[model samples]
Target: MLSRSTGRTRHVLTISTLGLTVALALSAALGGPAAQGRAPAAADAGWSSASPFAAAGSELSGTVTVPARRGRDTVVKLWLSNARLTSVPDACRSTVTVRERASSVSADGRALTCLVRSTGSRRTISLDALVDGEPGQQVDVTVMVDGRATPLGARLVTPGVPVPQPDLRLLSSPDFLNADVGDLVRGPGFWRPGRTANSTNADYRRALDTILDDWRAERPESVLVAGDLVEGWWGTEVDRSGNFGPDRTLAQRKAALRRAAATYYPQWKERFAERGLEVHAAMGDHEFGDNPWRAEKRRLAPLFEKEFTKRFGRRADGSPRYADRPRGSKHELSAYAWRPRPDVQVLTLNVFDATAGGMRIRLDRPQLRWVERVLREARQDGVRWVVAQGHTPIVGPVRSHGSSKLTYEGGAHSPLWRLFKRYGVDLYLSGEVHDVTAVHRDGILQVSHGGLFAFGLTNYLLVDVYEDRMELDLRDYATHWRDAPDGTRLWETRPQGMPKHLQVSPTPFTIGTAVVDGEGHLLDRSGILEQYTG
Candidate 1:
C-alpha cells in the first residue's frame, strides 16, 4: 500500500498480490491515466505512475511524486514493489537504479543505484529523487530494473521561493559499540565446542542492521552519535590464552593499541556508510581507553586521542573537518562545531580531560571558553537552534543501563550547564548512561539516551527541526541477548567475553516523544520523557 498526504486528505493505492502484470492490465482496462505515461491529475494527490514493465520473468510496479511547489531541496520519492527477479544464492545480489530528470539519483554521494537482496516475497524500494531542474519545469523519472528501463512519470511544478532554512531531519544514537567481527583469538580460553575468539557477535550485527535499515527508511539527512563508537580496550594487553597480561612493555602495548585501532575503526565507520548515513560523532571515554584511566592507561590517553582525531577530526587535505573549532587547543580536532544550516549550530565536545591525576569528565576551561564564544556568536548571528553533544551527561539523576554511569563532576551545577543556560542552548545530547532520561532545566533540555548494543537496549532519537518547533521521537528496539560459553574472552575487557548472541525485534517503536517550540519551551511530551519536563 502506498499513501500520499496532501493537505488534510490522504490518497492511498493498494496493489494486490496479483503481481505487476495483472495490476497493469487492470489499470489499462480501467483507462487509468498512469498506464498512459502521463502525470496523475491533481485529484490523484500528487501521485504519478509509469507504465508497468516486466523483466527476467519478473514484474515491477512503481510510482513517483513531487511537490506542487518545489524548493531548493525538492524531494521526489519513488516507490517500487512487486519485484521478483531471478534469485541469487548470495546474501544480496540485486540492484535497483532510479534516475530523475535524465540523471541518476545519487546515494551516499554517488550514483543512486541501490544494491538489495530479497528476504521475503515482497520488497519496497524508497528512493530520494535528486532533481536539479528549475521550478515550473517538468521533471521526468525513470527506473532501471535488470536491463529494462521504464519511465515512471513526468510532472510540471512551480518553484517556490528558496528556503533559507529548510526543515532538518536527524537521527541521534550514541554508544554504538560497533565492535570488530570475525577475528578469532586463539588460546587457552574457556573451551566450548564451537566457541573460538571473542569477536563481535554475528547475531548482534544483524540486529543492529535491522535497526539501521529502519533509520534509512526514514531518510534522515545525518546521524549524530554522542560517543562510544567502539568497545575500546585497545590499550590493554591480553595473552593468546585470553588472559589479561599487564606485564607487556609500553612499546608492545602501544603497538597493539595501534593495531586494534586500525582493525576496528574502519569497521565502525563502514557500518554507517553502508547504510548511506552521514554521521557526526563526539569522542567518548572508550575512544580514550575507557574510564578510570589508571597510571598505565593514562600514559596512552594522548595516543588514543591522537588516533581518534586522525580519523574523525581532519579532512582529506589535513585541514580541520569542522567549520568552527577551538584553535590552539589540544582538543581542537576532537572538540569542534559546525553549522548544518543557517538556523542550527552543532557542537561536539571532547569532555574527557586527561589530567596528570587521571581522566576527568568535564569540559576544560579552554574548551568551555571556546564554547561560550561560539554560543554567544551563534545567538548574535540569529541562529535559532544550538545543540551541543558530549559523552557524559551534565544534568544528572538520569538512568543507566549496563553503563559505568560516568558523568560530569558538577552535574547540573557544572560550568558547562551554566553556560548552556546562559546561552539558551536548545538541547544537550549525551549518551554515557546507556538509558533514556530527559531533564529540562534552566531553559536547556538535556536528553541522556542510547543503549549498549550488546545488552540489547539500543535506542535512538529522531529529531525533526521545523521553522517554529522541533519534534523529538525516542525509539527503542527490543533485543534479546544470552551469555556466551564460559571462558570466552573479548580482547582485554570482558575476560569471559561479552554476549555472543543478540536477537532484535524487526520493528522499533516510539517509547517517548516531545515537542519544543522555538523558545525552548516544552509544548508537550509523552511516555517516559514526560515526567522530566516539569
Candidate 2:
C-alpha cells in the first residue's frame, strides 16, 4: 500500500542547472543514484510515450504499467524525460518525483534523484516506485518534475494478490569468541585459554555445540554471529624472544598475525560450515585489537583489513560491497547488510570506526550518513523490521563488558543512534557485554550475549521473528571443562559451576525477556519454565 499524492503537473520552464551539472554527471556515471541497479522487474513494467503536460514549458507526461500480482509488493520503473518522447524516453531536464496511493508503508520525502552520465550524455534517468499493493486495485502514481508538487499522471497495475509467507523461521545469535577462537597456550607448560583475552575456545566450542544442538530443532536458515570470529585482538604475537622480551617487531608482528589469520580464519569458517549454518559476521572489537588499541591500531590495522576483505569478498581497494564512504576513510568491511526475510533487514556496523573521535568507538560521519541513507531506502522498500548489530552496546550497564562513556553509546546523542531511533529500528544487537541481557531504551532494545572466560557459561540468543512481533529465546550453557597439564582444555558435564566472574545471571526472568515498543520484548524465561537452572 503506497501513500497517496495529489495535484496537477505544471513544470517550470527554466531548467535550473546552476551548480548541479557537474555533480549530476559525475554522480550518475559513478552510479550514485542508480548504483543499486534497475529493479528486478523494471523491464516488465512498461511505460507509455511521453507527451507534453499542460501548462509546462518542457514537462512530458508518462504512464507506468506493471502486471498486477496479488498480495505482492509491486515495483514499477519508468524512464523519465523533460522533452517529448521520440522513443522509450527516460531522461529528464530537471528532477523527477513519484508518489503512490495510500497503504501500510510509504517513503519519506519520496523524491527521486535524476542524473547524467557525462558532460553531455544522453541517457535518461530511471525512477522506480515500490507500491505496497492491495488485491484487485490499481495504484495511481504521479510523476512530478523540478520540485513540482503535482505529478504528471502515471498508473501502477498490480495483481493485487496476497504474497506468500516469507519462508523464514530462524536467525541465530551466537556472539562467537574473543581475541581468539582457539585455546591460547601460555606460561611455561602453558597456562592457557582464559588468561588474558577474557575468553577461551572451550567456551566458544561448547556454546557452538549447544547452539547447533538447538539448531537441530529450530533449524535456522541464516545464523547471524555478532563478530569476533577469531582472536587476533591486540594484533598478533609470537612466543616471547628466548627469555620473555617481545619476540616480533611491529612489522614482524603484523606479518605473523596475518599468517595466523590466514590459517585460523579458514578453521573458524569450517566450524560454522560443519554445522551447516549460513553465517553473517560483523566486525567486533577483538577483531581489531585490545580495548584502547585505537591509538596503536594503524601499525597493525591492515593485517585485519586484509583478512576481513579476503573472507568477506571485496575489491582490492578495500571498500564494502554496498556502501559509499567518506574521504580519507579506509573503506573497510566494517558495515554490511543481511536480509533474512523479505520484510526484515539486518544492518551490521563496526562501532570501532576511528575516522573521528580519537580513540573512542563511534560510527563516524560517512558510515553514519550511509546508515541513514540505507534506513531511508529500507523504508522505501517496505521493510518492517531493521535489526542493527554492532560491536559495542549503545546503552547498557557498563559493568564488566560495555562501553564506559556516552561517546561509545551511539545512542540519542550520536548521529548514528539518533538515526536508528528516528527510523524506528526494532532491535539493536551488540557484544562486549558478556552477560546475556536486554536493555530497553527510548523506543528500541539493546540485547547482547557471549561466552565468558573459559567454558564457564555462554549465552546464545535465538530470535524468532513473526509478522507482528519478534520473540527471543536466550540459551545459556554452563559447560563442564577442565585443563590438562598438556595445556589442552576439555569440556565435561560435572563442573557444575563457574568462578564468580563468569557466572550467568541468576534472574532468568529478565535475562532475555525483552519487548520493543510493546512488540518483541515479551519473552518467557525458558530456564525457569523448564526448571533447568544453571
Candidate achieving the largest TM-score = 1
Candidate 2: Cα lDDT at 77: 28
> Model 1 Cα displacement at 247 (Å)?
6.8
> For residues 1-534, what per-residue lDDT tens digits would candidate 1 score against the true structure?
011011221112222221222233221211211324444422211132442221111112233222223222222222222211111111122111111221211211112233333343333443322223345444344333332333333433334323223289878998886343433333222323354454655675687689788888878888999999877777465334322223368876776666666666666777779989988999998888776678888898889988887778877688778868887777878898888889998899989888899888888788889999999999999999988899998876787766788988898788888888898999889998887888887877888888777666677877778777776767666577777577344443434456777788775544456766788887545445554432
TM-score of 2: 0.54
Candidate 1 lDDT: 0.61
- What is the lDDT of every predicted structure here? 0.61, 0.45
Distance from true location, Cα of 199 in model 1, Å = 1.0
Model 1 root-mean-square deviation: 13.5
All candidates' TM-scores? 0.66, 0.54
Query: Candidate 2 residues 86-127, lDDT tens each?
Result: 111133221101112111111121233232223332233323
Indicate the worst ten consecutive residues by lDDT in candidate 1.
1-10
